[model samples]
Target: MTESTHAPLLTVRGLTRRVGTRHLFDIAELVFRRATAVALTGVNGAGKSTLLRMIAGLEPAPGATVTWTEADGTPRTTPLTPLPQALRRQVAYMHQHPYLFRTSVRDNIAYGLRARGLPHDEINRRVGAALGWAGIVHVQDTAPDKLSGGEIQRVALARAKVLEPELLLLDEPTSSLDGHAREQVIALISELAAEGRCVVMVCHDRELINLPGVVRWKLGEGQLDTKHR
Candidate 1:
């Protein structure tokens, strides 16, 4: 792990995981910072997504421990592994093929807020802002399943944004996108990083990996290697 004077946004220790008989990762200590975009690249089945899932607390491996220091200097541990339902709102994971419910785009964006028991009016306010932010307000009333691949990507990102997450995990945001869609997702990523939202994304696209000011890392042989700025 790289050394930094500032405190990390999140820290993982004694983490180990495996799929069947193949070993995935055995990380001792890794620190993630805020307002940064991490582009993780590796060969197929190199455990890129596995690492993201672990951090998202979706799958907790044995001997794994995750922690983060609160703004008040208090540490949160129990709710670390297998992350609590409430904390999940602050740390979200987006798969390459995001699932869209049968509802309108606006409803889909507001789903998480609704689950959190936000008022109806508040949900509408946030959802409307998110749609405009993603430049998809025109299709706010459209069925999610009817959108194009790029539109779906934007909506998925907008979903993540509406929650005001401190950490956003993305898996191959541009893997299925065409040139234009790729550009759109890339632009959004830039904005997210600028907003100081910690973003860890799994992607191998040269266009994205070469993006200025992003932390480039390689995941191979169950290790994380810093390769760029």
Candidate 2:
């Protein structure tokens, strides 16, 4: 972890996860500061995704507190209240492969806003902005499967970005893209962090994580290493 030891916006304490005979994470404690960019890197099967899933509440992690700051500004180590439903909207988790709904790219990004009860014009405006930000404006009407790998990833990112979630959990978002595409995605991630949304990305590329001011965490040997500058 970085020596600064600042108060964390997202705190994970005594987190433990077990699958059969293997202990995925053992009482792991880490914190993610608000609006910061944190890169998680490790070899295959290193529990990176599992850890992210735990934070997103997709899987159960016992003996831990996923705490958020109270209105009064006091720190509390409490399991989130009203659980899954509330967390789902607050946390946006994007997988390595973008999941397209077999619909048009516009519809895919619009789905998130519509779910939040946004009006048609408002949804259109947000989708347009997201598409432009993701650099997929040219493919706005194409079927997701028909788009190139980079385009698909951009659309996936657009879906998550349009939601404007508090936290974004990404899984190797640039792994399948070419060099230029990867740079574009990385830039977008940097911009998101600059905009004050906490972004946790699972990426193994050293260069990619070296984006200005990003913190690095290595997951290996059944544990999350301290954050590295």
Candidate 3:
């Protein structure tokens, strides 16, 4: 979809994070647009990951107010300290080194659906589709220990994709990849953005930051500088 057709998916105001007397970032306002991807860049110790975690509801942002726009255009606003369950259901967060279950790749991909109590048939269907979508169908029965770094990342992505989240938060997704593996992950990220999801990625990789049509947001000196809005 084109930028012109994109709508506001989430908005944040009065966001702040701090460690004792050290301020990480203090943003007055920020907006995440649907069908768009944002590459969040910053120097070491700039709290890029912290901000992402807060958005994913994995961290506390007592001063922040998050507003999510639902499919029917209903706006729901809440404090970041205790993000509502409704918001958590629509956001998915992926770590740079994703943790996988001890079971088979397919089982790992199906974990989320099982957690949500999806019907057996529907879970199976979604798991199968996620495996194929992530190009890991061949390793459906393989254990996590046997998979390579790239394969592990793919499996993690499939796990998240199966849930069909509205907002995807990725923290340095390609940091440990190289060659074909890096390319594969990059391609998957692009596909995710193309599907009309709001993708917020924290990375220092120039290639990912420069991905076609990715909006860049840099955090430094307790402020966020956004490029291309």
Candidate 4:
């Protein structure tokens, strides 16, 4: 991964999650910088996925303080209750088993652009580029049901990449894939980081964990052990 001289894109303080009366995890502070890739690791039920969900605004953490720093050095901090649309647009989250629309791969990739009401030409341009970028152009017209696991994952990545998010959150992106398929996803991930996007993934795969320049953060015993390389 190329080193980034830019400021951190997102920071969180006092991040905590609980289940009933039991605490799942507590993170004092977490920082994510552009052009960086982080692998969050821990044993089962360590709340790794939960943390990513909270950051993506898909889960609630009532008292957590989340701050998003813009490219212009402006900082916007807010409680974790209601995330602003601006922040939401800057961060994209992909589940391990991504849920694709019951439509063609190209149409699925165009979903986000259409939702934002972009011009027809712009959506087409971006979708086309994204399809090629993810190397799934061969399956562009295929239905999700007809594609393999690797193809589906690549389609999901294209769907997220077309929006050009600054921060990408992935949960077990390469789980249960064949050797060639896994390599393809990992290469795409590296390319994403190289392009100056911050990527944080919940992963246990040694290949992903030991990826060059990847920082590993371990979550256990209700605390987060952060290590930067």
The lDDT per prediction is: 0.84, 0.80, 0.89, 0.89
For residue 36, what is the lDDT in candidate 1? 83
Higher TM-score: candidate 1 or 2? 1
Cα-based TM-score, every candidate: 0.93, 0.89, 0.95, 0.96
| Clash-forming residue pairs, model 3 | none
lDDT for position 35 in model 4? 90
* Highest-scoring model, lDDT: 4
What is candidate 3's CA lDDT for residue 163?
A: 96
- For 154-202, candidate 3 gives per-residue lDDT tens digits of 9999999999998899999999999999999999999998999988899
Off by over 4 Å in 1: 1-6, 227-229
Q: Where does model 3 exceed 4 Å of error? A: 1-5
TM-score, cand. 2 vs. native: 0.89
Write out the backbone clash pairs for model 4: none
lDDT of 1: 0.84
Cα lDDT tens digits for candidate 4, 122-168: 99999999999999999999999999999999999899999999999
- Weakest lDDT window of 10 consecutive positions for candidate 2: 79-88
TM-score of 1: 0.93
